[model samples]
Target: MRCTPPPERRDTAFALILTALFGACILLSIIIPSQICLARGGEAEEMNLSSDTALSKLTEGNESPAQEGIPVHVYITNNDNEKLDVSLFIDSELIDHKSISSGSDQKMDRYLLEKGRHTFKITWWDEDVKSSFEVEETRDITAETSVHLYTILNDKPEEYEITVNLVNENSRELEAFLYADGSFKKSKKVGKESSAELGKIKLKEGIHNLSVRWQDDDTKIEYEKTKKLMVKRD
Candidate 1:
């Protein structure tokens, strides 16, 4: 036969068991919630990192480049006594211009041109008479450049153009030198049976002298021709 413990000792053992059970329940509740929170936080951080990387790649894929050209300037003056309508062109492409009044000047500041030979043309007409005239010049530009043009409108023979008929019959290549009023204008090269261009210059209203000279060193042949041109103005 076994004897039972005293009442005080039995009650103390019961209290100890209850305390241990309560402690175990509290520990389980804290640990399980902490673990769940850690797992969810890690998943959220990974998802945010992936989104940022994709956004960075998409932004870097959509960039672009720069552009380039040559600078140019143009100055125009109207020398006549009437309102004139002017149209300008570069390489046969029309450029916009405003109508100029009598004895007025127009200045165009910065313009972009490509690096090559370009032709500049200006067409002007008298607003009252509707008579139109055109002048053009070509230049090979490697860098920055400037162009100056004058518009002249008159009824009389105020300006004259000098033309030379270059005839080459010799077997050897012949070159001719042109002179205006004893000043050298340009040189022309001519081949056998080919008509060559000698260029033209605007002459003021007067009696002008035009001459052409050519020399052949092999044949020792020197030749010169002179002509008098008269321009009349009203």
Candidate 2:
């Protein structure tokens, strides 16, 4: 018998090898698409988390809160539903402190302060689940308030009129009231449009308890100042 060349067997082997290669290429294409989708989804999630964190920090004011010298008993109200830390300062130095609840108003007793200008600093802290990872916001509330210096003097009893020269330390408007025998005798607005109340009150010959009250609408209390003078008939 003559040995044939086995051409059919050779052709069958070549076709099987080609089929395996095509199957491998299809599997690789499918896996590549799945990997690319996973990567994009992960990146999107990270970007969203970063954006949310940035917005939360920005909507809140500046971090690292502080303030300078402010007035004594100023009205402070917390309009948000968060705890607030309040610090009182005198000439940029920390002195007293307090905490206020949300949606509540309270007054500070600034009477402990000396006669000078001061500032108040307030800070808001985020309620942290972990104390180490907390954020804070600070704001400085200013008060140009100062003690009113006033003195009621006779100048000269013979002048027959009380001379009340008011020297206001602050830029705000000042008012003076003359009280005699428990009645408001006279009142005048002083400072800037500075005024003088002369020849308005006539004196009687006796030791009179003349009370001079100086007050400003910005302050909480009336500055009690008094003087006694004896009148002599000319």
Candidate 3:
């Protein structure tokens, strides 16, 4: 026959059991999920920008030395629950950077850019991705190219565009110029990582002169090309 324990002893054993159960719950709360990936800001603050960051650029007038350019607008939205650090680049040049809060969006101010193809790259990371340690330094996102609808000039009702494809290089900038009937008509500046286009145009259904010019970044020499483009009915 088993003998019953004293009341005091039974009460102490019950207290010990209660303490063990509480410790187990605390451990589970801290370690059950193991890892959490969150996109948090580099700092607790709202924003951080580069030194040369220009939110927006004013249009250049004809007398101004700056080349006249069009505006490029970018809109980004964060659908995640955590904060995110984002960097923006144009043609391999770092333009701006900021940390956006969770469930919000950033409408990047319009930047003046020469009319042509441009590479708009955005590298982003979460705050709690892997380790807090320098995730921005080891960023792995490649810049994605953007496309826009461009209007062209044409003599006939039918119209077509001439696209200038260039080798993609982060260190090189290229430009292409087009002339029709011996007069300058169109020109395009290709950013470091983008392809240029001459826009859509309808020719006069005859032999026309087309020229392209750019400097060889590797060779440090100027290059030019002239071609005779024939336009006719199929």
The TM-score, computed over Cα atoms with residue i paired to residue i, of candidate 3 is: 0.28
Error of 1 at 158 (Å): 13
Note the clash tally of each candidate. 0, 7, 5
TM-score of every candidate relative to the true structure: 0.41, 0.27, 0.28
True lDDT of residue 132, candidate 2 = 17
Residue-wise C-alpha lDDT for candidate 3, range 1-234, written one tens digit per residue: 222212220001000000334334224333442222333655333333222221111112313376555656665555546666666667788887777666676875667776555666666654433422111211212233222211111122343444433333434555555555557665666566645445655465557776555566567676555667777655
- Poorly placed runs, candidate 3 (over 4 Å): 1-67, 131-234
**Model 3 lowest lDDT segment of ten:** 9-18
Worst 10 residues of 2 by lDDT: 9-18
Best by TM-score: 1
The better-scoring model by lDDT among 1 and 2 is: 1
Off by over 4 Å in 2: 1-165, 192-195
Q: What is model 1's C-alpha RMSD?
A: 37.3
Compared with the true structure, all predictions reach lDDT values of 0.64, 0.45, 0.47
lDDT of 2 by residue, 126-229 (tens): 34321211122233334444232111111223435544444344455666666764567776665643444422566655676666566556555667455566
